[model samples]
Target chain A: MIIEIVSWAAVGLILVTSTVMLIIHDWRINLGALALQYVAAFWLVTRHLPFVMGSTKLITGWMVVAALGMTRLSLSSEEDDTEPSSLLRGGWFRIILMCIVALVTAGVTTRIEAIIPGLGLPVIAGGILLIGAGVVHLGVTSEILRVIIGLLTLLTGFEILYAAVESSTLVAGLLSVISLGLGLAGSYLLLAGTSPPELENEL
Target chain B: MSAPILWIAIPFISGFIILSFLRERISPLIAGSVALILALTALIIPIDTALLLGSVSIKISPSIQFFGRSFTLTTADGTILALIYGLSAIWFFGTEASGTANRFVSLGLMIVALLTASIAVEPFLFAALLLEMAAMLVIPLLVPPYQKPGRGVVRFLIYQTLAMPFILFSGWMLAGVEASPGDINTTIQAGTMLGLGFAFLLGVFPLYNWIPMLTEESPPYVVGFLLWAFPTFTVIFGLGFLDRYTWLRTSPQLSGAIQIAGLFMVASGGIFAALQKHVGRMMGYAAIAETGLLMLAMGLQSSEMLNVTFLLIIPRGLELCVWALALSIIKPKVTSLKFNDVQGIARSYPFAVTAIILAHLSMTGFPLLAGFPPRLALWQEIAGQSLSISFWIFLGMLGLILAATRTLAVFVMANENKIWQRNESWTQLIMLGLGVIGLFTLGLFPQILQQFLVNLPALFNHLGQ
Candidate 1:
């Protein structure tokens, strides 16, 4: 019963953190939410995967957040200052969107649970919530950093669900590699995107 | 050594080595040489068969184990590996003349290697992960140093990454479908997921807006390489799906669905291409149209589907090579590649202009050009099936022709007093000339590719059987 309560709490935490990520404009708070989001994802993943294997997702997710944080730190004050104000410039609309996403997640969780029989209700709800929030995040933003974050979120949701399906060590390792690679690519784009353009013809 | 080690690992490792150790000027030469050698070796040496080299017998095994998984490159894969690497060699070699040798050659090699691995990897579902890795590698290549990533490049990454989950989930469902072939619900669900996955990967119809946007944002040469490489591999990967699933291939609705999708891309791409103000975006749309033709070839009911597909594939590489090389040469000379900026460009770079026009015409299926014969074959087959399908395809072709005509008029729009001069460097001229000659040769005598096409279908064990 305790484990069940913890799983339900983890699902609730995921819903809150993912919504925070969508509504918050502050990078630090956003990254913090993402970190907590991973913790919740790790707990849910452990329900299906072993703790040792599931921890990779946590570690990778934290590392991704760290890498992006460092990239953000390295940016010049002027470059960093270009970001929009905290609490998102049209925050109410995002909140409404999040509510809609929540409803959809609730509606789809039961169907997904029926389709993939072995998954528990909490796992299905958490995964679908993350996916719904991620897609909404992607649909609304065109920022490079946010898009990367959104992709990571969507993939995390997939990993959570897929853990219940296939558990090959190599597949797990490759997926981790891809996560790290996306983080590095995001870093590269962040750094490159901020730098001044070179004058030479890029033929 | 095994074929996977030879084709996948070596080139991949060499890419890093070249990036780190070699001088920028010599990197293309070394990389191009290595790719050419690999292609030639694949062509000359048979995998999984013993070769008597003057009484010293040697065999190149087809599969190699890695991390409890296997990557198998059998004899059936030789023609494709050769074609991919050989075409890659051409792209790499031309980088020097196009002035993108430094940034393109290394990552280009690595991208090709990863793509090859995607094809060779068994359990096949893993190919999605490998393709995603390949797509990630593309970001660095597309974005120049110190420049902001454009919406196009970001969208490209997002779309490519998005394909993974759908494909992986579909593969899981497909395994279930295989266990109980009578389950219609699972089959339909799996099929829908698979179609959505590929539509994103191939940039079919609605999802392909990034192509033109990317062309507008990046160099013509880099985008050209992507246009040629990504779709070609994705098509082959899609073919693998058809070959592996009996139910999928035999589904009565499959051919018509694929045909309709192909026609939509062709018609949309062609119509859009005709309306584009920028030549780069025009090329993007044309590529979309070409990819449509590839899909159309796969939709053919005849056993000759594979042959017609290869016929279209081989010429596309050469056509893009010529067109891109010409554009690269002309880009620095003009203010931009927009029609207004390139007005009367032929007066300054006659050779480059001519090459561009010829490549454009070839892609429009002009007679005596490389894209003509395969297009003719496609028209014949489609006409036999449905007159409306043939008519739509023809309309697409006419749109492309109108695009070419507009491009020509723009190029030659000059005061009669303006002098015609060739400004291209000898290397650029020579490469462009060779590419043009290749296009003509393939067109006038399509039989040249028959040998390669004959055995290409063997890669798909069940398709067209």
Candidate 2:
């Protein structure tokens, strides 16, 4: 009973964290969410999982590496560093605006899910649609910097789907790995600008 | 005491030690010798399974039957090890190529170690992680100065890393067939997983960028290794996964989905390669095209595709040598990869010019050289699949032939002037000769690698089934 409660609490924390992480658009905050999510996941995976332990460790190790990749996030956030990027100059507004729109849509769906019988599908669809929008924003843009933002948004959708269909050490394990990979990528996308200042730190 | 175990351990230990001590001068050279020894070990080791260090005995062939499933290594594993080591042999030789080769040798050894480890281990997910890390190492190597700062490397790393979770997720999904053993999927979960596994391997849709960035910035030889070796392992590993999950292989729809994804790669890779000029970048497109071919072969869902895989390796191997030899001479440096740079230089280096043409022609699949036969065979296979698709295959082939022609034109128009040449060296001629020799040898005896190719899938089927 005690173990069951711990696992449930862990799952709840992860869901809330995932939702909160998606709503916010800052790299630093997302990094924190990523770190917390992995730690919680490691806790989650260690709870007497029935399958192979080697498999569990290997998958989780990938997650930790990704979460640890937040170090790059810190390095890239510094100014006049490398790759003078056009996207980094002040392009946060449009993305922030999009997030706001996604949030409003998400709010309406949550309320609908309370009353309607089949509203769950629409809720999931809304979430996936918002992610597709994020992909489009990043895909068409020439500035690689924004793609990281796009990756973060897409991952948020994947995590939600990942969480929805299954809630166990395995899914948690996978989400953590995917999240870390996305984090590191988001870190690099920030590095894509070719401004002269960015080149020095790269080598 | 197994050769599989030892072949796995030595280079792995050497690779890590070499990387940790990368700043040391002799480390890489020593690492290369260690890798060479390991490759040799893979050759000599007879296939067998036993616990050396607290190993678990996984019985299937002769029946450890628990819900009617079997998994065991047949004697055929020896050939796979041989193939792994064969590629590693040349890569180990690459250790002697430059200062970078030392570290490259370490990474290459690690790659070998991972491949060796994956094959030995039971759960396919472990192999997937091993492959992912191997892909990740390509990042530091792919860093080119002119391309957008560290972003490309980071993006490559990020995208590859991102693939991990889904693979792990799928690993968990498929873990049932192996662990407790049951019908496994909760309906379409099997199909969804099969899709994710394919996505991870093919790097489908928006998730594919590392290939282009790495090819563009990487040293030609290194690009050559990745172009051929990594995909080969990935396909093998992916097949191992699909083979384990009965739903994927048994269902034609699942197989068709994979084929569609691969076909997309072939079409896009062809279009992309034709539009590019840099030799390394061009190699990337060709590789993408090859990935699609691998998929198409897999899509054929026949052991014959595996035969094509065997034949595939020879031309690709020759092509790598050809590309590496050609690129080392062409432009000679990043400052001048443009066609104009090599122009009039043929007047300065006649032997180099001829070798470049031969190399390019072979790489582009011209007749009577290395690339011709496999391409012809590939056409036959695609035609066998569907004559309508042959148009797409031919169009793709045309794109490759056209790319080759463009590259050759770049050389010819550079104004061949052997009489005005300054000088030539014996070693350059020798390496060039070896590449020429390899191309011709494979071309003349399209059956040179036939024996080995025929043996491989049978082996994989034996182990996997």
Candidate 3:
């Protein structure tokens, strides 16, 4: 009973972190929320996947966060200037979007459950919430960092749902590789976007 | 030796070696040679059969096991392997002439290997992940290092990545459908997911905004290679799905849906192509229209679909290679590829200009060009199905023809007093010259491809049968 409660709590944590990710523009806070989101996702995934396989998601997610953070640290202040002037700038609109996402997710949870039966309500709800929040995040921002974050979030949500459907070790490994590849690609794009034109031909 | 190891593993490893160690100037030649050899081997050596070479006996096995998954490359896969790597060789060989040799060859080889693996992998659902990996590899190639990535490349990544979950989810749902074939609800859901997944991957209609944007931002040669590679493999992968599932192929509504989707893409792509002032963007639209033709081919009766599709695909690669190479040769001389920027370019680079116009017309299905015969065959087939479908396709072709005419006019719009000069390098001329000759040869004798096209359908088991 306590395990069920804890899993439900993890689902709740996913909801908060993903919503925070959608609204927050600061890279550090967004990355933190993404890390926490993955932790919660890992917790839920363990209910379906083995502990080791589920942990790959958490490890890959944190490594992605680390890679992006390192890349962020290496950037000049001008290059790192995606931070909003005010915390509330468009934050409220995003909050409103999150609210709509939450309501729609609530409405669709049962139908998704009906389609992929044996996926518990909490898993379905959590997965749908992340997907909704990710889409909203992607729709709202075109910033490189933000787009990468949104894609990672969307894939995480998918991983959570897919973990229940497939348990192949090879699939798990391939998915982890994909997550890492996205991180590396994101880092490359971030650096390349900020570099001077003279340096373009060097690579 | 195993087929997968020979085709997939060797090229993959060679790509890495070339990237890590080889000089940029020599990489294209070596990579092209390797690809050509692989293509020839696939064409000549039958899998699962022993061959006596001089005194030694050799056998290439059909399948290999890795991490509990199977990758089987049978004799039926030879045509596909030959087609993919042969076309890849052409692209790689022209990279030097196109001036993308430094960035294209190694990565191009790796991308081809991954795509080949996508075709060979079992449980075929794994093909989605392989394709995603290939898409990721394309980013570095398309965007030069330390350059600001354009919205086109980013959106390309997002859209391609977005396709994975849809396809995988549909694959899982399909497992259920396979067991309970009568379950309409699950079938509908799975089919919808599959359709949406492919619509995104194939860049059908609305999802294709990134294609033209990509053309504007990246080098035309790299974009051209991508345009050729991605859709060709995806169409094959999608054909695998239809071949495996009885209901998906048999459903008339599904076929109609595919035809409608093709019609929308063709009509929209053609209209956009005609309206575009930018030559590069116009090429992108023309590609989208050609892909729509592939989809229309897929909607035909199973007996004729494979033949028409192969005929269409063979010419597409040749046409894109010529067009892209011509554009690359001209790009350095012009301010931009927009109509205004490139007006009167033919006065300087006559050969390149002529090649571009001819390639564009071929794609527009001009008579006595490579793209004409398959298009003629397609028109007759679609007309037999529904005259309205044929009419819309014809209208699309007309739009393309108009675009080609406009492009020709821009090329020739020089001052009357200007002297015609051969500004293109000898290498560029030779390459373009050969490509032009190829277009005419294929167009004049479409029967040249008959031998390979006869066996190409064998790639799909149930569909071929």
Best by DockQ: 3
Which ten-residue region of model 1 chain A has the weakest summed lDDT? A194-203
TM-score of 3: 0.98
Q: For residues B65-93, write the lDDT of model 2, one tens digit per residue.
A: 11122223345666676667666665455
* Model 1 TM: 0.97
Model 1, runs deviating above 4 Å? A81-88, A197-203
Query: What DockQ would candidate 3 receive versus the native complex?
Result: 0.67
Which of 2 and 3 is the better model by DockQ? Answer: 3
Q: Write the per-residue lDDT of candidate 3 for residues B271-306, one digit (tens) a residue.
A: 889999999998999999999999999998758888
Best by TM-score: 3
Q: Tell me the spans in candidate 2 whose CA falls farther than 4 Å from its real position.
A: A1-33, A39-203, B20-36, B49-74, B95-101, B144-152, B171-189, B204-209, B301-303, B329-334, B344-359, B415-429, B462-465
**Candidates sorted on lDDT, descending:** 3, 1, 2
Stretch of 10 with least lDDT, candidate 3 chain A: A78-87
- Model 2: per-residue lDDT, tens digit, A119-163? 243334334533554455454443333454455545554544344
Structural similarity to truth (TM-score) of each candidate: 0.97, 0.73, 0.98
lDDT of 3 by residue, A33-85 (tens): 88999899998888899999999889999999999999988988876565656
